[model samples]
Structure formats: structure tokens, C-alpha cells
Target: MPEDVEDPMDYIRLHLLEKLQVLLTTAALLAVVYFGLGRWFRPADPLGPIALLPGGELGKLLGIVVVLLVLAAVAAAATTRSRPEGALMTALFGLGGVAMLSPPMQTLFWSYPASMQSLYLQMMAEVLIFAVGIMLAEGLGGLVRSFMAKICPRWLWTNTLSELSDQQRKTLKKSRIDPMWDKNILNGDSLSVSSGVRNTLLWNLLSLSLHGKNRTAAQKQVFRGQLHRGFGCLFSGVLAGIVLLVLLLQSPERGQILFALFGSFVLAALFAHHLFPVRTFFVAWMIPMLTAVLFYALAAISGTGNRPQYQVLPIDWLTGGAGGAILGFWLSGRWREIRIFEALAQAPPE
Candidate 1:
């Protein structure tokens, strides 16, 4: 088993009922937000419940998506350790949340009414808010990971003489591992030696403690450093989206603004794929999800902007967030092999 298995889902085998409860609880929370947002942002002369292509029809399609994938999650739960199950759950919950787009969320309005142009602007702005917020949360998680690292070094343990293969011995020779750890801790044929240190992580959600000294320390640093770089991707994405939103806001043909929005998502996803090294991609996607839940409260406080009066289907915040999340998960993964690929591709300047 890969040592990176510290997330809540890792405990599925340990606590099946708790994981089930968590899933159901998330679904229940989203349900509350669904009808609650429906009433809060409903139109004055409300549109029919079953109306518009992107409204009810798109929701039905997403509902189909949720149903199909949820079964996948159930099967994944039955496994000993399904690595992809985490990603599957991320997609399921992300899409499941977005699948509940009601008429209220579909049609937005400001202090006055929102023009078609303003609606696109508002939508893109919501995307920015979500993109930034998720990255910020991730960065915070990273900080917590690094903080836990100081305590982790105390729990360090080393493997024995027989445990070290020819390859492992060669690996150990070049590193900073203490000779004392290997010599003083030896007894007979035991593989590893442990002192009076707790082997579990202080916070599993942020950092998972691995079984060995080298692997745990190495992966924790990877988690800290790699997660920090996601902000660069986040900055690039936010900047690209903002610049496009500004330029398009002035254009006479407002439909073109969606191209900017689409391009923004595509560009951001590409940057993250290339740059944000993921020991785990599920968290990257998971962070940016529930955009509607994250931002609807803000919209309520600031007052509404653009409430669509027609039988129109404006793409809501969830579209960018949900779609972006799925795309991010699909595109990103561990970067170790990527480094090898880079080393082989070309040489550095002399």
C-alpha cells in the first residue's frame, strides 16, 4: 500500500459506516442549499419549475451523472484499497452538488436587473472567487502539514539489515540517515525499530503519517512544496480570467464573453496539469467544489446582480467549479515520472 493513504476515505475500511454517514451528510447539506437557494433567488414572476435547456434539462443530465457514479463509489467502498475511489468520490460529490441547479440559481439579479453582459461578468467573477478561495484553503492545509512535520520527526523509525535489499542499501548509503539509528536499534531479525513516538499523524486530513522514516518525511515535504505551487497556477488562472472579463465586458456582442470563460477554465486546467504536482489530485479538485455553496452567501450579503427574467439558462458558478474540478482531476497526478521525462527530454545549459 502506498503511504499516502491518510485522507478520510482511507478510513473507509476502518470505519465503513462513518464514511457512509459522511457521504449522506454531504448530500443532505447540498439538498438544503438547493431548495434554500431556490427560494432566496427565485424570480418575481417565477419561471416554470421545468423550464430552459440548461436549467431543468441540464440538471437532469447531471442527475444521471450523479446516479451512475454514486454506484461506482459504492463498489469502490467494498474494495480493500481502491486508489481511484477518492477521485471518483470527488467527481461524484462535485457533480452531484452542481446537478441541483434550480431556477433561482439559473437566473440571477442585482439591485436593479442584470443585463446579459453583466450576467456573464457576474458568472466569471463567481468563478474567480471560487478558484481563489479553494486555492487559499489548500494553502492553509499545506501550512498545517508543515507544522505537523516538526512533531513527525520524533516518531522516526528505521529498517533492519536483512530488510535492506542491495538496492535499498545503495539508497541508504547516499542519504543523511544516522548510523546510530541502524546500529543501536538492532536486535535480531526485526525489520524496524521504534522509540516512544506516536506513529499516527496529528491531523490526517492535512498530513498522513507513513510507516517508515524516509517515506513519511519525504512525502510530507512533497505535500507542502507541491501544494504551494498550486497558487502560482491559481494566480495565472485568476489573472487570465480577470483580464478576459474586463476586455469582454466592454464588447457589444456579449455572447463572446463565454469564450473567455471557457478559455479561462481550459487555460487554468492546463497550467495546473503541467505545474501543480499532485501526490493526490482528488484534493485539488475537491477544494474548488461547492462553489455555489461557498459564494451564494456572499451574493446574498452584497444583494443580487443579474436575475434572468426570460426562460434563459445562464451557466452558474457550479459550471465553472464542477467542470473545472473534473478536468483538474483528470489532468493531474504524481510528478515523479514527469521529472524523469524532463531529465531525458533535454540537458541544462552549460
Candidate 2:
């Protein structure tokens, strides 16, 4: 027999065993990232809710068992021992560990008094479970990605704007003569249009230009043009004052709501690049900022509605006022220019 040749079935078995070992390693790494990052940044949080489980100790014991099982499985596949006594023993230990780590096993052992040993066991168990879960998910995700690559339509993921509707596609095409959308929004000293609609459209255009891939120089130019045209303020003072009031009175418990509100506005403003020819970045950003302020105000007035409240008055007002004033001035200037432009357009061109 050739030195390198092995039975086909045997080789297949070995490969499978090797794959499992690799999976074990991957699980270990992922658990570390998830738990370690969370701990380092925010120590107050107990290592994921999993750490709180009753069978925490058993989980750690099971992790050790899994390691042994993987080793034995690999050994059995590599060597031609009829009994494979050591392999089976290792496998048993691993399985025993798994059982200990299981939720049911932990529940059964709930009567065990808490101690340093118990705490260590729980932490270990949570880490093991997390690692294994992430490894399994990663393995499945790889399969999904491969399937998507093979099965998904190319047009759906491609960057070519020719796929859009005629109106949208026109914004994508290069033109010597500027479209009405571009001319109206982009011909200003500050590089933005005052109209909410125009700003919104420009924002979308920029986003499309940035989608899923790098933009060509031409695409970048288009994006820049739209950005310049769409950058302006809308309702200046009234919006500013309202925003300031809300920030001054926002409560801590409503942080999530505030975060969501601000996050959405920022995201919309960013996406305004995709909706070209409309100048809506300022307006889009304003939407979220306004929402955050309003949410804060509501939460404060309602006493966080069954949640703890944090005092944030002078600081909130100062920050909100500064931001609002800048935004207000820009919007007021843009609004004035837009009106003037409209008036000039109505008059006969000199």
C-alpha cells in the first residue's frame, strides 16, 4: 500500500473529528470576546444574564468534558485501536461535563450552598455555554453566507443605479446640464439648499452613492454637490427653543428613548446622501435631535413614569442651547436665501 493512502471512510472520519476540535477552539475565542469586552467596558454588568443561572458551576465542568471529548474523538479517528478504551473514557468525561453545565442539571443542584467554589463554577459554566453557542451560530452563519453567495440575484446587491426608477436613476446619471434638483439645491455659497424637500433628496443621493461599495470620483462629486446644496436650517428659533427646554428637563431613565430619537435623526441625516437633489441633512438630523429633546421633556415631566430620574438641568440646557443656536442660525439663513431665490425665479430673468 502507498504510504500516503488511507481508507476513504477512515479519512472522512478523521476530517469530521478535526472539524469538531476546530469548532471547540472557535467557541472558546468567541466567548472571550463577548464576555471580555462587556466586562472591560462595563464591569457593573454580570457576564451576560447567563452568569446568573443556577448551574453555573456545572457548566464549567461540562466545558472541560467537552474539551476531553474532542481530544478522544480525534484520537479514535487517527488510530486504529479496536477497543479505543481511553477514547471512550475521555468521551464520557466530556459528556459528564456537558450534563453538569446544562440548565436542568443546574436546577437540580439549586440546594447547594453558595460559596467561592460555586461562584467560580457558575462563571465557568456561563462562559462555556456562550462559547459553544457562538461557535454553532458562526458555523451556521458561514453556511448561510455561502448559500446566499450562490443563490441571491446579482442585481439586488450591485451598486448600479440603473436598477432604480426613471426619476431616481436620472439623479444617478452624469449630466452636462444640471438637473433642476441639483441647480436649485447646489448653487449656494455654503453648499446646501434651504428647502426641506431638496435637503432630504440630496441626503438620499449621498447615501446611494456610498452604498455597499466605494464611490467612483464622479459619484463622489455628485454626492458633494448634493451635500453642498442640501445643507441648511429650517425652523430656526422655535425649533431651537423647544429643543433647549427638553434637554434641560430630560431624565436618566429615558436615556434609551433619547438615544433612539437622536440615533434615528443622525442616521437619516447620513442617508440623505442617498436621496439626492433634496437638501435634507440638516432637516433630517434636526428630526432626531428634536425627538431626543421632546422625549427628555416628556420623561422628566412624567417622573420617568415609574423609573428613577436623574437631574440634568443646567448642563442639558447649555448643551442643547449651543447646538440649537448653531443649527437655528444655519436654518434661518438658508430659509431666507430660499425665499429670495423663489422670488427671483418668479421675476423675469435679467
Provide C-alpha RMSD values for all models, in order. 13.9, 22.6
Candidate 1 local accuracy as lDDT?
0.35
TM-score winner among the candidates? 1
Candidate 2 backbone clash number: 48
TM per prediction? 0.38, 0.23
Off by over 4 Å in 2: 1-36, 43-156, 163-224, 233-249, 254-350
Question: Per-residue lDDT tens digits of candidate 1, residues 256-322?
Answer: 3233334444445445545543333433343333323233333444445332212112333333333
Residue range with the least summed lDDT across 10 consecutive positions in model 2: 155-164
Q: For residues 61-120, could you state the per-residue lDDT of candidate 2 as single tens digits?
A: 344434433533343332222112212222222222222221211222234433434433
Question: Which residue segments of model 1 deviate by more than 4 Å?
Answer: 1-220, 230-263, 290-298, 307-320, 332-350
Q: After superposition, how far is residue 176 of candidate 2 from its true place, in Å?
A: 19
Instruction: TM-score for candidate 1, please give it.
Output: 0.38
Cα RMSD of predicted structure 2: 22.6
